[model samples]
Target: MTSYVPEYLKAKNRKTVFDLFLRDPELSRAEIVQRTRMSFPTASKAVDFLISRGIVTEIGSEEPVGRPGRRRRSLRFNPSAYAALALNFEGRVLEVGLVDLAGQLLQYEQHAFDCFHQTENYAQLAPMLQAVVEKSPCHVLGVGIGMPADIDNNAETVALYYDRQEVVVPLKDLFGDLLQALQLQAFYGNDVNLACLGEASLRGGAGEKMNLCYLTLGTGFGAGIMNNGAIWLGGHGRAGEIGNTHLGAFDLKGPLQTQIEPLETRINLQALEKAFGINLLDDTVLPQDTQDQMVEFLLPALVTAVYNFSFLFDMDQFVMSGAIPNRLPGLAACTEREVNRLLAYRKRSVTISRPVSAHCTLIGAANAVFEGTILSELQG
Candidate 1:
């Protein structure tokens, strides 16, 4: 970590050049030196390192602005220089995608399976993922999977949630064949956390500091927090368990030992179905008042979470994702209005809404690979 260390200096210089290309997408050695205040030789060495790694490309040259005679070779960050295979298992189907260094989802597909056929899940997606890795046209960074489960970073495993319960499994063990065959790194996390990270990347998180929170309501409620542009994973990587946070309690269920209930018990789809006597997720039923009823039922719980997150984190943006908000427009709008009103009283501004892209989890899984690999040097 010392400045006098040669490796440290070299890594630092390469990072500086890498960041420059990210900002401008194209830069000559002269331009890099001028903007970075580094000497010509230092910039050249850094650019050379990136080029050798295939991350920097010489895309010809052009006179930039006023320098008419200064037509030097232009170098750009090659976004497709490395790729990550991203897979999202949303309980039933696996949403697979291929992503490049630039955070773009280059390819995507889905493979459906029965909840009971859990053993066949990863094994089934192997071919599709293998095909993606083979055709990636660039070095494979790794494979990152987002699933409804608890992730153990140290253990390199996940306890996947499916068929209404969690089954402990090492994700790498599931994809061991493909991973070993392709010689790729493996990354995985809770689907909601990945979604939050994905949203941050889309919002230019790479270049700035941000405190953002993402909330999703489904059969299970969850929250993902990004503080200062980095995921706020608590010591155990389980910080955003807002679902288990208590917003309210009632003695109606039991007067003695089990009277209290967590917010998730009330905010999830089962609560909605129990109150409405219909499956909210089932699209066949056309109940005219379904949306209205859903909005009212979820408003209080949603307000509680948003209010707490906004007040505690001081984050201005909240992306409330998941099928509930995406399918029911009224619910998203109501959550926004109610949460904003509470925050306005404290002179704090916040925007509560849905994710801009549907492929958020997929993209975020890919970003995890980049964070661990290509961006790791710059981050340090």
Candidate 2:
């Protein structure tokens, strides 16, 4: 049964119609009315408002109607309605991209980093970013930056615990000048979480009716949970901090450090070098063939975390994303096998699977811009 939708929600419905048009430029008025579940008059009113505001346009007519009274007109969102900037502010580099509401990357620029975390670090990043955005062809809606820490979106600030470490200084203030200099509104979020959102929205999971958990395994690890249809950012925006949670203690100086240490410290490219005298980066090696060792080492510790998360969140599907190659295949299969092994010996059965890709966080961050832009219209 459909519940009553409030007037405010109806206004939101209008934006949803715009989003549908943006996602599918060939949608008809009748299709919008049917998909959005609003009255034909209400849907037409929304379309009229959008067209009047220059946010929507009648692209062309649909195919000849076989059994209809009249042909329907196809509607599309104005690609030039607004623009957005997306950045993946990783510890090693800054990836900047200019995109429209349709998630098209019209332009992009990448900047290498000499420093990992410093107060004055982003100063250099500002000019490089401003240069790219300044050349964009659309009215820039805002800039979304992906970082490695938890953010308080409401206060527009990074949280307390994240600012304590010298390696990861206060980031909110540093990003302010870059955003202000470009005259763009800036939003910050955890990189892994952003990547998950991107993957869920842009790729294979778009229309899937299921819960998704994107786990990024790279220099660090984090989980992005999408339940129902929206990203599940916990009450304080820290629900996805699975990497920080301690699974257990390992000897720092022991040879087993590479095996029992945390997944981030164990599976990363650098950690592999410190453990097994080989550099995947320098060797120009494919992660698939070389990452099995790291995965074999870190699988147990990760399983504990995954099982605990399942117990806490009751989620069944898991995705292993982020940049490690051979790591995911063995890691995912091992994690699933272990979980199932443990579960089989216990009470109930469970099903688990690996992520679609390692770059889910990066893609998820991109989708964040798409999701935010379309949803912002509803807020207005």
Q: Judged by lDDT, which candidate is best?
A: 1
Q: What is the per-residue lDDT of model 2 for residues 78-132, given as tens digits with 9 covering 90 to 100?
A: 8667667888767667677876655567776667764334445466576777777
**Model 1: what TM-score?**
0.81
TM-score, every prediction: 0.81, 0.76
lDDT, candidate 2, at 316: 75
Worst 10 residues of 1 by lDDT: 113-122
In the range 20-84, model 1's lDDT, one tens digit per residue, is: 66567777888888987889888898888788778898989777676567678888779888888
Q: How close is candidate 2 to the true structure, as a TM-score?
A: 0.76
Off by over 4 Å in 2: 1-11, 18-23, 49-55, 63-66, 77-81, 114-118, 159-172, 204-210, 248-271, 286-291, 326-374, 378-380
Alpha carbon lDDT of residue 94, candidate 2? 69
**lDDT per model vs. reference:** 0.76, 0.65
Q: Candidate 1: where is the Cα deviation over 4 Å?
A: 1-48, 60-75, 114-121, 160-173, 249-257, 284-289, 377-380
